[model samples]
Target: MTSLQHVSTISAPLPAPSRQPFALALSILLTAGLTGYLFNAQDSHASLVLLLGAALGITLYHASFGFTTAWRTFITTGRGKAIRAQMLMLAVAVCLFFPALSAGELFGQPVNGFVRPLSVSVLFGAFIFGIGMQIGNGCASGNLYHAGGGQLRAIPSMIGFAAGALWATRDYEWWTTQPSLAPVGLIDMMGVVPAIILNLLVFAAIAGLTRHLEKRRHGELERDDNGSDQPWSRRLLSGPWPFIWGAVALAVLNFATLALIGRPWAVALGYPLWGAKAAEAMNLGLDVDFWGYWLMPGRDTALMGGILEDSASLMNIGVILGALMAATLAGRFSLSWKMPVLQWLAAIIGGLMLGYGATIAFGCNIGAYFGGIASGSLHGWLWLVAAFAGSFVGTWLRPLFGFSRT
Candidate 1:
């Protein structure tokens, strides 16, 4: 080939990733049906929340936005691009969230953030959750999307997650008794503007720190994939999106969630409910109501009512179905049954830790770290510090379970 032709050929867009038409069709059909059901059964708001979750799944899958992977990469290789993306995400989310929370509503709906106590339970739980993220190879949202994207490994992790969350419920009251401060929201303590400024400052500092560390280690910042020369429309439809795009999309969708549902986006809350429902089905001798957690007013109602009645459950379902749609559209939907015994053990144990830790911590990465921080809650910052510490240890342990640190 001539020089010009060679250059043109090299720059040309790569072939499209294969699309799983059947899977795509299935996801589309299910999404449509669910939207109708949620609208009729609950309200327009419920339907909208489900769609927002679908949007979140698509964003997550396309951008490969994952806390576990980002933290692990930073821990193992000092690559800070993904970590910086996380900061961008947080910054955007805080900006969107704080204004609404400060006003105490979004649109006509009264809204609330995920502000909770800073407690020993949170410290210990977030720490273990970080470790779980490394070993399980996925965090709360990660496992859901992975499962949705047809990763067989996530199945075992989810099963263990459910079981572990159930186990935590058995002793939920004990965790509540631990030493803790009352809920402290930056927005609540400081004015909204001040809280936003503080959060923005912290995000910038973290991002800058990562850049410095990455530069020191690699002698330059690592660049993200710039993407091929495909049209933006095609890339949007079947994407390996830029991380910055993912961050922005997530922030917007999360804001949508708040406006629609009067609360931020959260998924881990669904795990224990599914677990309890499953246990009930199997006639597991455990009396769910006997647990103090379930004995709470809303908890009892959720357990007794149909799963569709629960907003979190609906959103979680949407996430999975949405991810499936994204995966199939990207022609990346496939499964593997083969897992080494050691790796399998890691999945189960790690999942258990994730489930248990999230339950005690009152949320996972999405709920605790992302939602908490976006809400300007002190606990969110605590969760971040503790989880990162745990992730550091978990990264070191990955090789023992046959996972590469990178």
Candidate 2:
């Protein structure tokens, strides 16, 4: 008897659900809630408004940089001096901060944020964060914005980062109790004018270094006939207007986020919050002080208590939505889940490292490095050094982990 052969078709497992929608919704709701809280909250800092402006500026910068052909070339070609621009901006920010602090009008109010110098913790934290970013495929700021654009890898990286952060937060007290590397608030000594001049000098030095490097590399490319030897001027002007404007706009957005939120832009804390909540939900009995120490909660008065709720959580939500809106409008949005399992694992691990490292550093690249530099903190510079060193190490290991060189 010829039995009817029953054949079952096996299909590859369906890709993980896109969390973009959830991310978007959560962002909107959180933003709305925070806005309401700010409007209704009795105690407020005037510096917040200026911080908001900075946040806006940051957003503009990112968007513009991403879309701009010129900026892209500067980033990818190594010939265009994007790094120089960044250094210039950092110097400018440092100069501006001291003047602003002295004049009490930099952000339209007296500057209150304390500026601190480098520390051992900052160096160590930066190394860890830098390595984490390389493995996760983006830095803290890069991850939030990119994840919004539908990079599945970013999701895992973000998760890992948060987990790491949570772990770090639990140990924050001990970390802070350690000895600091330099005197806190070095900018306070030099005041505004000298600081600005110093920064400009540094900028000039970096420009000279960049020019030297470019000239050295020019002949090699010419001999190879790679057609990659574009002039700096041409590279700077290659992208359309939107790209340039978009980056500037993002920079403004970053400023705005800070002003309104009363904190610099960040992303790792959200993950830690989630982790903490999960731990609590599972009855793990984690210490509340751990979260509280990280400014997870605000101060409390006899009549009322302040809470440091998750601001980044909302900001991240908005970031994803904003990016999604941009991508969807431009037809650049696509669903992708093509990463290999090992890479996925790496992303998660890297993210966790980022989370922990960022917490120990008291911020991620955005909050600590970018904002820190802009705020005239010496630790910012240290972070860059450590992180870049870590990035180099990460790059060396990438091939071994199946990552493409490109």
lDDT of candidates 1 onward, in order: 0.84, 0.53
Q: Which candidate leads the pack in lDDT?
A: 1
- How do the predictions measure up, each by TM-score? 0.94, 0.72
Error of 1 at 273 (Å): 0.4
Worst lDDT 10-window in candidate 1 = 1-10
Q: Compose the digit string of candidate 2's lDDT tens values, residues 136-229.
A: 6666656555555455556777767767877887777777777786635545767767766776787689767766766677732212111124
Q: Which residue pairs come into collision in candidate 1?
A: 18-331
| 300-381 per-residue lDDT for model 1 (tens digits) | 8989987888888888888888888887887767765577899899999999999999999989999999899989999999
Error of 2 at 215 (Å): 2.8
What's model 2's overall lDDT? Answer: 0.53
Query: What TM-score does structure 1 among the candidates reach?
Result: 0.94
Model 2, residue 229: C-alpha shift (Å): 20
